[model samples]
Target: MHGPEPGPGEGMGRAVLRGGSVLAAGTLVERLARFARNVVLARIIAPDQFGLMAIVLAAIALFEALTEVGVSQAVIQNRRGHTPEFLNVAWWINVVRGVAIFAIAAPLSPLIADFYGEPALGPVLAVAFSTMVFTGLMSPKVYALQRQFRFGASVAITQGSGLLGTALTLVLGVLWQNVWALVLGTVFEAFVRFVLSFLLCPIRPTFRIDRESWRDLFAFTKGMFGLAFMTFVVAQADVFVLGRLVSAETLGLYAMAVTLAMFPLTLFSKVVQPLVVPILAAFQDTPDALRATYLRLERLIWLFGLPMAATMAVAAAPLLTLVYGPPYAAAAAPFAVIGVYTVVYMASMVSFSVYLAMARPELQRSFTLLRALLLVVSIYPLSLTYGPVGASSAMLGALVLAMVLQVANLRRIIGLRARAYLGTLGGGLVAAALVGALTAALGLLNLPVLTLAGLSVVPLLAVWGLLLFRERHEVRALRRRGGGAAASDR
Candidate 1:
């Protein structure tokens, strides 16, 4: 008799590499779209508008995170057959949650306007809030696509729709000349994603809910809710503190710095995290398999993660001046601090996924809560004193501490040594430091932007190339094993 069919995680190591390739390609295109939009947006909109929107978005993000309920993760991690009744329950629950968010946000818009002294915020937030409903309507079939590693179609639907939406925003922003363009663009993007997800994925929702079906899933969802809530706080705490304590102008500067710092992390993490969860979850029962997978992922993350952070930190001045203009040059300082923090943040993200995959969701929530508390308590006083700079520095300190704690916790749980963890990260730090020092030395001579940009890449590329060469054997071995070769490597 034939055994069970191959599950999503059975060959997840290879599948992750494939998924990462698709994600990377999509990320490159998305990065281009974002770069073009920001270049135009920086010129058209004032920093205050970004700051105002940032505050409103933070609150909205909290709501969205809570609404996740980890249903998708629960479905993915469930090794048993996909039951129609369970999916139906999740669908209805999401719809109800979306409606609740819209209702709450609608009445609360006035409060947000009052807090920010921006009367326009009330309507802007109302329009933006509609996205939650559309996002909720997306079929769980999308996750099925992810589970099967059918990412090419998913990437096209997601990135292509986003590109179109961004293009619309650009045209509208130029015509309308304010935040309405951004609000509309966002709403349009969500609507497009919802429609496309259903169209591209084949699963249909049935209107059947079985209480027995949900019994096995509810605990996982509860754990994820706590994890999501705490993650939201940690992610947005700095922005919230800055908006409340600092001037709008200062908050705007901080917002810009944050956007710059987060772009790389967002791009890379999007590629890694999705793949990590499924891959690690596949090997959950085998400690050796999980540990090996984690190490490989850690190395892969640092290879790109470190250089991106380094390049941003080293080239912050030129990059900001080129993209945003000289008036926003103050963003450079905070960008450097936050860029380094992002490197540590990315590592912590890996640990977070590992814990989730191992079904130790409480550990994930505990770490998130600890990080959030540290971030809030530290940034508040710093924002009060030194303004955005102090707040950025405080956040950097907290991120480093959080990463250390996360690694320590992972070590305790997995019984791994710290030396191996540090080994993965140490080379990247040394390379980044060298590049930064070289960039500083070169800056003393007052080079032109073109010259500076060209010159700056030399040290970075050299360091990066050397590191790749140093790991050449392992890279080859990984490729020989199930992992598909990266485009660049191929």
Candidate 2:
């Protein structure tokens, strides 16, 4: 018999470990600074400023998502990505796209403000849309770094941007005591990120646009845009509904709650998702290998994500009360409900890289569109009775539906059975359930929020340790050999 062949992604685990640590450490520092910034800003600025900022942001994202050309994903997935011609063309297309968004969003700011019934929003959006222009100028080399797992520079740039933005926002918020700090701070972050991307990425892109490259790149973007738009809608549905129906104060409170609750989601976006896509792309041609990779990441991420959700959910009331102080005390109930919602929301994100890896982005598009439309139908009616809490529930329901569809889609794509999926993730489910239960029980003890939350995650850590120990072999394979099959399988 042949000696063990090389495992998929062998020897890449060291890179992943290095990259993950860089991203995680930087992200943790960035997040802590941001939390402090939020604490200071929340006190200085009124809730209306946050509500205004959210709407402006949501609008800008809507336009940007609509115009996305899949330039980044194409670079990551395409073989020609390293060629100067491809990078230049993708860069130009994105630059034009960004400019177009700014042009349209700037003039249309008044209409958006009108739609939201907030006159002050018009000016805030005008400044906020400037970020899109700089955002377009970022080098595609960032994707190259991700594809190769050379995230050190990219992580530094991101952390730097976060720190700069937080500091600027704090200073400006204190001085202006309005939304100018938030809006301009965003633009500052975008400007700094673009500068850093060019410096970090080894690619020296030029002005030339290659015809075939544009066609190939646009082809991918055509498929991706619908999915991006639907995702935007799903993500911003609460803002869309509540911005119209609720008070600014109410929207601000809900924003704080969701921000606190979406910690796992933020971490997934900032670190996990980017790494997974490139790694998954490596295994795409081999179905068995792909399925193995998906299950391992899925199960492991579930174990890690479940506890954060449980802790945040159980501790939302006091977390909000403690973090933002008494002014936001009224936000606790909606915060709790949305906390639970966010944990379940994570289910939708699990298979995203799998779908993209399999070149089935349209599946994500269709399912997300279904979810968004369903939310539109459900949210208005729900908000009529349940208020912002009702809107959160509706959005969560959409997420659940989307997740079920993702599982079915994954089955069709890879022949992985649902029973196998359930079996693999059942431990995570149980751990999360136990954490939630214990948190609720301990919450009755009337401890401080930090103390209560700290206590809540103890069982999570224990369960996680037990799972890690049980799966030490596979875990070791993931850590030592990279994110693929077990060492024995090689």
Q: Tell me, by TM-score, which candidate is best.
A: 2
TM-score of each: 0.91, 0.92
What's the distance in Å from true for residue 390, model 1? 1.8
Over the stretch 1-490, how does candidate 2's per-residue lDDT look in tens digits? Answer: 1112234444567667677778888888888898889888888799988988888888988998787757788877775665678888888887888898898889998899999888988888888999999999888777756665667887878889889988998999999988888998989999999888888775566666798888878777777877778778888888888898898888887787678777667876777777777667766777777787778877876776676567766676666766786667677666766766665565556577776665656667878888989898998999878888888888888888878777888888887888877766676677788878877898789887667756766766776778778888876665542445323222
Candidate 2: list runs displaced more than 4 Å.
1-9, 448-472, 479-490
Task: Give the range of the ten consecutive residues with the poorest summed lDDT in model 1.
Answer: 481-490
Error of 2 at 95 (Å): 0.1
lDDT, candidate 1, 22-41, per-residue tens: 97899679767977897788
**Candidate 1 segments exceeding 4 Å error:** 1-14, 81-83, 469-473, 476-490
User: What does candidate 1 score in Cα RMSD to the true structure?
Assistant: 4.1
Worst 10 residues of 2 by lDDT: 1-10
Q: Estimate the TM-score for candidate 2.
A: 0.92
Which one wins on lDDT?
Answer: 2
Clashes of 1: 0
